[model samples]
Target: MCGRFALFTPVSELTNKVGAVMPEREIHPRYNVAPGTWVASIRQASEDSAPTLEEMWWGFRPSWAKGKGTQPINARVETVATNNYFKSAFAKHRCLVLADGWYEWIKNSSPKQPHYLCRRDREPLYFAAVYAERDDGGLGCAILTEQARGSAADVHDRMPLILDDDSLEHWLAPDLTHKETIHSMVRHIDAGLVEHWSVSTAVNKPSEGQGDELINPL
Candidate 1:
């Protein structure tokens, strides 16, 4: 699961990359964005124009799950297509959780080591996500996860479903309704396209790690 990730790219730059409008308010770069906090997401515009960037809560509390003990931050891709909690969103509320990179912990060793994973070419990483409007008039989202493959499995058993450029538009296609067709469009990052290195353990503490230094390789 993508418990923590970073997005230090400037809003202006993100707008250019996703063809979305910038938020009216300033967005400070966050090197460690965690669950229960606001995060940037890209969704199709209401007017059928370029997608728009939105600030949504990171945890997904289904409209029917009010007052539940713990909201979900990640949904399993294998079950999402049919799970009642996520199937509706999977059918209609698709989105992209924008990130420059994410953190995964290698737990085999004592004092698990943290790793920063991102595109080898350094482009933005777009995590496949689904969102729902809450009863309180706010949007919340959960990232999708699949069994880790290749080198990524060495760090963790699951990883966010990172989308490639070819899949972005298909993932966010607003009116698409054929479940099998949508499932066919899901894409995973080529293992060779990604790279990771050990990062500071300070990332273990969300408050202290939301800075550039947290991403520096150890």
Candidate 2:
């Protein structure tokens, strides 16, 4: 699951790569972005609307479920499209979490080791996601995850559903609500292109906050 990530790519580079308008506020490079914080994302309000960069809470819960349980940060791709809790947002509120890379801990490892995962080319990536309005009126989102593949499998049983560029616009199309249509139109980033390496465990603590040192190879 994508519990933590980093988005240090400059706002100008993100706008150029994502083809979304830059937010009025500048985005600071954050190396250890934890849950419960507002994060930059790419979203389309409607078919006719241009995609825009906006901040959204990293945790998600249906309005009715708010304050009822823990906010979920990851939504399994398999059930997200049909789960009553997620179907509505999955249908119309699909979005992309802008990230440079993410950190994952090796399951059950002694002394627990964490690793940094990113594109082999070190280019930015977008995580498939859906958002809903919170009781307080802010948009909160959950990253979609699928069974792990490639090197990510060694770290955990699941990994964020990283979308390929061709699927970005289609993934945001509110009109395409059919699950099959979505499956056929979107594709995950090729597994071979994603790689990971052992990193400092400082990421286990969110208070370590933003620092390139968090991602440095151990």
* lDDT for 51 (candidate 2): 86
Residue-wise C-alpha lDDT for candidate 1, range 90-184, written one tens digit per residue: 88888889899999999876577899988889988889999988767799999999998777787898999998777888888887767899888
| Model 2 spans > 4 angstroms off | none
- Model 2 sits at a Cα RMSD from the real structure of 1.3
lDDT of each: 0.85, 0.89
lDDT of 2 by residue, 1-218 (tens): 88899899886786675578887788899999899999998888887888898999999976788668568999999999998889999988999998999999988876788999999999898999999988888899999999999988988889999998888889988799888999999999999998999998778888976889988898
- Which runs of model 1 end up more than 4 angstroms from their true locations? 45-49
Model 2 poorest ten-residue lDDT run: 11-20
Q: After superposition, how far is residue 128 of candidate 2 from its true place, in Å?
A: 0.3
Give RMSD (Å) of candidate 1 vs. truth: 1.7
